[model samples]
Target: MPHIFTNRLGGVSSGAYESMNLGVNRGDDPACVRENYRRLAALLGMERGRFALASQKHTDIILRADFRHAKNDVFDPADFVADGLVTRERGLALVVFAADCVPVLLDGGEAVAAVHAGWRGTALGIAAKALRELGCAPGSVRAYIGPSIGACCFETGPEVPRAMLGLMGAEAEPFIVRSGEKYRVDLKGLNRRQLELAGVPAGSIEVSPDCTFCLHDKYWSHRYAGDARGSQCGAIVML
Candidate 1:
């Protein structure tokens, strides 16, 4: 499995999307977004047309992708709306975009998956669902939880914690802490726990310590830059 979590560096987009902006519908120049994909394809030794991007909408939907889903350019409209993509086809790269949301990559030996886990998606158990979609023994799967908003900066009202608690019960308590009038939720930790609970070994899951909101200069952060920001992606291909 070949995988990468892109950052805000190394592209041609300018202004708020300066440099590597992989998101196509984020108000970024379409030409610049295409060039960013080109650069990424070159770096990964993959064909630009072999990439299958998820039309993420913070849902738990997972799609099994193949060459038919590949797009020749970033401007092409996605045929499906899913927050996660799983594929056993070699050379058909699966990609999921994220700013302050968690991007998870799974390598299940014969298959691979790319998942975008926003708070809503996490509550819907998108990570575990993606793992189940892999159709492999969980212990045999290796996962990477990419950079997102950390607990230190993810201040939210009661709704977020309530949603997590309803899904994870007592298991979600440790990751959600009181923050004066609000709460700080650890989305990465929750996603990791979901993977582990689904049978993936804790040691097999590598969690990135980088917080998108904290390292906004290196990665895109929706909370930090709002709607004007670009999005990075987590891409995987079984080759």
Candidate 2:
């Protein structure tokens, strides 16, 4: 399995998008976004037409994809909406886009998955769902949690912490920090905990040290750049 977590680098988009904007609907020029996809696929040594692009919606839905879902055009409408995509097909890439949201890659030998986890998707356990659907046992799977808004930059009202606590209970305490009237939740830690709860080995999960918000220049951060930002994508292919 070969996987990549991209940042905002190496492409033709301009302005707030700058370069390397992989997202199709973030107001970047359609042709530029399409070219960016081609460039990405070329770097991965695969045809851009063979990639299965995820239509994310902050849901736990993990769709199983193969050549049946492949398309050359990244801007084309998707037949399905899912936050995660799993596949066993070799040379077929699965991609999920994100700005500040988490991008996770799971390698389970026969199958691999690309997951986008915003707070809602994380709470819904999209990572665990991908593993379960791929028939991958937790211990056998290796996970890479990509850059996103870290706890230090993720300040929210009580509702966000309450939701996290609802899913993780007291186990979510350390990741949730009380900062005056707001709470800063470590989404990466919480997502890892959820994966562990679903049986993924804690030792097998690797969390990115970079935070999108903290390193806003290196990566795109929705919190830092709202709707005017471009998005980075996490992609995986079974070789």
Candidate 3:
């Protein structure tokens, strides 16, 4: 299986969506976005039709995908509104899009999942949900937390940290840093903790050091670029 977290390089989109913008609704031309997807599909050595996408509303919904859900178009409405997708079916690639939010990839050898974990999704424990849907023990899953808005740049109000506390109690404390009246939430660490709590071995997870907000040149950041940004997608295919 091949898995990759895309950046903002390559492709035909121009202006705010300078190049390689995979998002279909961020004001980028639909033709360009489709072309970008074709490029990504080419790199994966699969046709665009093999990709199964998540609708991504920041919910914990994990859809089980197969050939029926596969689409060649990224702009088409998904059959389900989900933040995570899992499958044991080979030849179907799972993809989820994000700008500043975290993209987590999970592989259990026999199955694979792709998740979109923003603060809301994280609070909802989307990571664990994906693992559970794979029908695999957490300890056997290998997780990779992709580039996202790091805690250093994710300043938030009480609601974000409070949601985490409500879900994880004191276990979420270390990942939430308070400075003045605001909080800095570490989305990556919070997701990792949720995976660990679900029984995933700490050593089985890998976290990317790249921060989307800090490295806006290489990645798109909704926090840094607002709604006029392209999206980065994390995709995984079962071999």
- C-alpha lDDT of residue 64 in model 1: 90
Off by over 4 Å in 3: 47-49
Q: Is candidate 1 or candidate 3 better by TM-score?
A: 1
User: Which candidate achieves the best TM-score against the true structure?
Assistant: 1
Q: Please report, in order, the local distance difference test score of every candidate based on alpha carbons.
A: 0.93, 0.87, 0.90
Best of the candidates, lDDT:
1
lDDT of 2: 0.87
**Residue 90 lDDT in candidate 2:** 94
lDDT of 1 by residue, 122-202 (tens): 999999999999999999999999999999999999999999999999999999999889999999999999999999999
Tell me the lDDT of candidate 1. 0.93
Q: Clash pairs of candidate 3?
A: none
Q: Write model 2 residue lDDT over 116-228, tens digit each, in one string.
A: 99888877777778889878778898999999999989998998888878877898898999999999989999888888887888898999989999899999999888898
- Give the RMSD in angstroms, all C-alphas superposed, for model 3: 1.3
Candidate 2 stretches greater than 4 Å from native: 47-49
Q: For residues 95-185, could you state the per-residue lDDT of candidate 3 as single tens digits?
A: 8899999999999999999999999999999898898898887888899999999999999999999999999999999999998999999
* lDDT accuracy of residue 92 in candidate 3: 91
